[model samples]
Target: MRNSSPPLEVGIARWIEVMRRNLLLASIVALGVFGIAAVVIAKLPNVYRAETRILVNPQRISDKYVSSTVSMGPAERLNTLSQQILSTSRLEAITTELNLYPKERQALGRDRVIDLMRHHITIDLKQSSDGPSAFTISYTGGSAQEVATVTNRLAASFIDWNLRDREQEAQGTTLFLEKELATSKSELDALEERLRVYKVQHLGQLPNELDANLQTLSRLQVQLQANSDAQNRLDQQALLSRSGSYDASGEQGENPQAGLRSQLVARDVQAHRDLAELHSHYTAAHPDVISKEAEVASLDAQLTQTPASVSSRTRRSGSVASPADAQETSIHHSRDHLAAEQRQIESSINNYQSRVNGVPIREQEISQLLRDYDTAKEHYRSLLEKTYTAQMSMELERGQEGGSFTLLDPAQVPDAPIGPNRPVLYSMFLVASLVAGLLVIALRERLDSTVKSDGELHDILPHIPVLGLIPRISKTIVNRSPAQPTLRRAS
Candidate 1:
């Protein structure tokens, strides 16, 4: 035969009766637990937290003209700064200065003290929509004033560290650029000197002189041609006058006649040659040819004016005629002068030709030197500009005009402790005590398996039927003396 389970309402009613019977014991246990919890909570130390807010300010200057040297963002910079500030040395210093963790330092030594201090320091970054990133630096301590002081000090330290870091970076960059500028300037100066010396050494062969050289060469060539033509005409005229007829073939012999007529004919041939040479080198209206023609006409007039009888008389005497001798001497002197002039013109032509031929070579060499010089100059100028910018950046950093930290909210002394919340502790103690009381009652019930109700009995024996029901007598009534002699019987 299977046993039947008790009904839900009957089980609940039986459990309520069992709890009523055990109420005194449960209350004793609950009160004891509550007392212990209260004592433990009271013994815990209170911890106060103080916080300060700092803003990461952007640079005052625009990035377009002068850029900031500090490139790290607020988040990255905060991480780095947290590491540095929380380092053992820094934390130890802070601990010593603030007189923090006296008991912990004594129990766990200085290293643990520093570690504990670092653990208590918190850095939380908060970014805003319109402003730069702001961060909160908070520290937990036993005393509110001490916590506030420590937090403020830490914030100040961060500000100082940021300033020193940025200034050092900016100054270092400036120094580096200054050194580079010096080197560039030196190089530029050296190149300038090299170019100057090269120009001096190769005076006529510089790229800048190319046009002037070409013009000079052209003019010299023209003068050379004119001089050569004049010389040739003079030679031809001398030959023609001596021979007394022009030779188209350029073949002529000296005249044997020794008189004024010979000299006159020589002079006339010279003049015609000069005019022809002028026509070859220039236009028909040349000044030199016109002047020579006029002289030639004057000479012809003098020749015609001389009497033929006078010449015959002189020829008969066979003595050298005075006027004819003078004429011959003059003609020889003029020829010598022409020869010297031609030699000078030839020398000038050779000089000009040599200069013209060397132009391309000089141009190539000068172009190479100038190319190098120009490159150096450009590099020097660029470095100079950067040097100026670096100097300005350094100054800006020194002035604290670049990205920096500003204390937005100074650390304040907290009025209340942040930890060991009393109300929450009391509430938790009450809940825990209630749960403990319920567990104890449940444990006792489980240990004692005897049936306490009719329903439990029914569950144990479903086929059995109750024959009778007896009322339980109270212990108080049985222990009491008989209503005693008051005895309703005697009454």
Candidate 2:
């Protein structure tokens, strides 16, 4: 039969026997792996991390007093600042100024150096109930002092960029509002000018002047009626005088002076009525009221002068009196003046009637103008208020009293390294070495064909019986002297 090792089985004894046979190989494998791990771990450089905390300080002034135009929250603000401060140009400048990453800059070039710097920098936000109230800037580097310095520099850059960005935003907002306010003012002025021109173009037909136009029309009508009445009386008197049947004693009176006095009194009464009506409608300063007052004064003067003139004429013509022809001529002359006055009044009435007729159209147009004017005025006022608030916000930003970032805890040089944990790494490698050693032993045992135990031989041929076991001798007679030639046999 072909000699071969017994089939392997799941037994502790078999594994123990196999392990003992390959103990030296397993030890060598384990020691080799452990040694390499230790050496590599020991040679690795130490990395130190330095951190700085920056608190997002809220606005010092109350929001009610002056609202900030910059409405970015802390996280968003930090993100924006990170973008600006961590740009290639900015990082390069900082590296050049601080003389960081000298070897990387020399070997990896400018771009690679900036990339490495960004990789080492970390911005961790710290949140609270309110929001992101603070954040920590961490930088890992080979040197302890270098990491600390870089972290502080990054924090400073972040703070400066935040301030500058916010100030620029505020200034821009103020400038924009100012421009808007100027535009609103211009529009307001244009509307005001348009209103003035419109009022001038339609003077007496405005909504406000409707009452005065009606009053003037009524006054003119009254004057026309009074004139007509006087003309009728004069015509009746002329007819009576021409027929030689005129009564000299009546309400008009018997003499020309009395008739003149009566006409003057009637005109005074009508003037007073017009004045009272005007007073009811308008104030004393109104044009219509003033005109009526003037008319009343003129009537008074005429009434006063008529008596003086009548008395003077009576004395001058003590015997020779006013003749019928003279009286009739005076009456005709008065009738002619009344006729002319009536025509003038009629013309004025037509003009005022046209004004009253056009009132609705003018009123509608004026209402639209007023509505637009009011809207524009309100808009201008609102813009003015916003401009003022924007100015105040700008001032607040300039003063650094608005939302800003402050260095809460400055970065300090780390006392110890944080990377390359030696003990833990050593333990991990020790366990891995054991696993590798066991795998090597199992592999060597699986490939070996030598049958070292009778149990394995019996298991391979279970149907056959094992009669005896051989105990091999350690010494051989060939290697010793021939006189000591003895055979060692197994039972």
Candidate 3:
């Protein structure tokens, strides 16, 4: 006999049995996937990382020109120097010396090692956020010890570069100034010579005053000539009177007005001045011009009314006027007047020359100014050149600077491996189990089709006496395998 039951419990049992069967299949598939994943993960190569830290401080802070008002700050100088270290040329040197890329890099003749070094390297600057300083260097690499070694090398190189730069900059600057000094001195000397020559050639010469003196001398000379002419005429008249050489009767006679040969002095000067103005303004036939012209003619006639003559010592002692004495006195008077005018002119010329001679001194000052300008320019250029050299040297020194790093913590060998994720393996295994279980369920359902249950049993034998019903147990929940446990099928 079999035990009878409702369909609901049997359905629940079958549902659970199906899930159990699926779970078993899933487990098998999961195991296989997890094993493969584990092997693959283990076969991958491992990479090790290395790092080093360093600090930067000035190695030599000796101030040679502390008194100089203009100088650069240390930080500015250091930073500028640091930037120059990133150049490939410097890296190439280090790489060659360190056997970094390969010894065959020299043989293969490829400078590609420089690029490799740059790629493998990393520099991290650790600046103080709270302080006014930023001079730390950090290098990282795949090789643990190599990173530190390279970092150390960089510091050393930078220091060497800095020293060399300073030395060269100083020497070079000095040389440049020296050359400029030479050129400036030469220019100054030439200017001096020119001034000296000018002074020697134009000694005791004056320009502005000389012209003024010359004009005065000319006027005075004219006056002296007039005076001499008057004196000569007076003497000549006197001589003529003594000899009775000329008279209105065309014979030698004495006349009191003869010695007094002074003409109408300055009388025609106004008329001459008016005539000149009229000549510029109008034609000579103007009315005012004709009246002044007639007046001038009348004055001339009055002045010529008396013939110029001189009286002799007539009958006082019956003295004969000595012609020889008169002639000698006239010559002596002419010589004396001419000599006085010449003396005045010479004195003026000498004064002018004396002033003109001072120009050479002024010229010398100009020459000095030119020399100073040249010297200053030369020094400026020299200093500029030195600045560049110093900057370059500082950069190299910073790069090779040995104190750029500090060993905060050194890496030590570890006893256990850091990783191959074991939990991820377990999760993968679970996922594979679900997939395989579903596949098995679908395949079995397709092959075997059945609809046997409690309701169907009642329908098949309704006339038969229903004695008992039995429940089908799920294979998954049975808790025993055919090979592991004794089993019996329900009947």
Candidate 4:
């Protein structure tokens, strides 16, 4: 079998010969492809991009004292602004105002024009360790001036929109707080009115007056005690006077001492009745009940002592006699005087006891009213404070002291176009054309299967061997040779 692989040097020589044979065709193809690329590159339009830089500045006031209500970060805010600025309506407005994409508008209508304009716009956010967050707004157009104008307009619109949005947010918050404050104030007023009415309805029963009520109760109790003691002393005096001896005969039926005793007994009965009435209203532990018991005991002791002292006096005066008629008349007058004194004392005691009994009831009622009033007052105060804070925050936003975007760099008309890079396009086209030319040469070389060298001839017919060889010569070289001498003889 014949070896199919040729030596490297022989293969290289064979390729060189093939290239030389096809040199003219390869050069023509390469030049044609390069020409087409140049024409296509020259016809493409240039695109110019203009950019504006915006810095997201921190709030003027420290956040430690007053924080900004706008909580969005630079990237998020940029995205939101981008959506708003690039919306259909906004882009349409920009397109109409700037006379942008006029040909596209005519060819594809308003929506397509707006879409094209949106496609031309771009936003990019930039952040650095040492500086605040910033972003760039850029627009591309066929003309440098138009691109710059559109970019600047978009930037200005964003700034205006941001300011307006912030102010509106602040004003809206303020308005809402104002309404809440009004509602809270109304509620507070209603509570105050209700409290006032409650206090009026239960005048003496408020908690704040508990101490004073206790003090008055104590004073009244003391007064009631004093009056009881005086009534008891009078009763004792009347009892002692009544205990004195009296003659049965030649006596007017009314004994002076006896009338006085009768009057004292009636006053004692009235006191017992008043005590029973007090028991129905108050417990035994109550001061009024205790005082009444002490008075009753004192009156009983006075009555018991008076009878013994009278018995002793009667025994000592056994030998003495007196007219009974004069005694009886004097007794009647004395008894009337005692009765009047007893009635006055009883009235004073009753008045004091009533005052003491009423104090605790009044205190409990007043306490409830005061508690409700205090609760309402506290709520009102809290709402007032919150309203004040809301007002301050609104004012801060109105003053434009919160986080905001500042135009760091305005868009300027570019001196040069940013796109339709002719050099790069030309380079790419050059490479593509060279590759096509090479591919065409390789395809032509592959299709032409004729033997061109000794190694190829050997591969085609390895069984045959040749002793003599005929060398090939160019037709031009053969024709250029001098003619043989036979031509001269014929002439």
Candidate with the greatest TM-score versus the true structure: 2
lDDT of model 2 at residue 16? 85
Could you tell me which residue pairs clash in candidate 2?
Answer: none
State which candidate has the highest lDDT: 2
Misplaced by over 4 Å in model 4 are: 1-6, 62-75, 106-119, 129-131, 222-249, 253-376, 451-455, 465-491
- The lowest-lDDT stretch of 10 consecutive residues in candidate 1 is 246-255
In model 3, which runs have C-alpha deviations exceeding 4 angstroms?
1-89, 101-116, 128-132, 162-337, 340-491
> Residue by residue across 225-323, what tens digits does model 3's lDDT show?
454444444444434443343343332333445334333413443444454344334334568857876876775575568554433333332566545
Collision count for each candidate, in order? 0, 0, 34, 6
374 Cα displacement, candidate 3 (Å): 12
Per-residue accuracy of model 2 over 1-491 as CA lDDT, tens digit each? 32353344436667887888789999999999999999999999999999999999999999988999988877898888899889999999989998998887888988889989999999999899999889999999999999999999999999998999999999999899999999999999999999999999999999899999999988877776676567657766765563342243232334456556556656765665565455445445679978987997898688657752233333556766557657767977986787678668766777888899899999999999999999999999999998999999999999999999999999999999998899999999999999999999989877888877777786688788778776644466335745443432312
lDDT of predicted model 4: 0.69
Model 4 C-alpha lDDT per residue in residues 234-338, reported as the tens digit of each score: 445544444333333312253344444555565674575566456445545679978987886676566545432233323446845333333534654654564
Can you list the residue pairs that collide in candidate 4? 205-362, 205-366, 206-366, 207-366, 207-367, 256-331
Once fitted onto the true fold, the runs of candidate 2 whose alpha carbons sit more than 4 angstroms away are: 1-22, 95-117, 245-328, 451-491
- Candidate ranking under lDDT, highest first, comes to 2, 1, 4, 3
For candidate 3, the per-residue lDDT at 405 reads 27
Model 4 lDDT at residue 469: 50
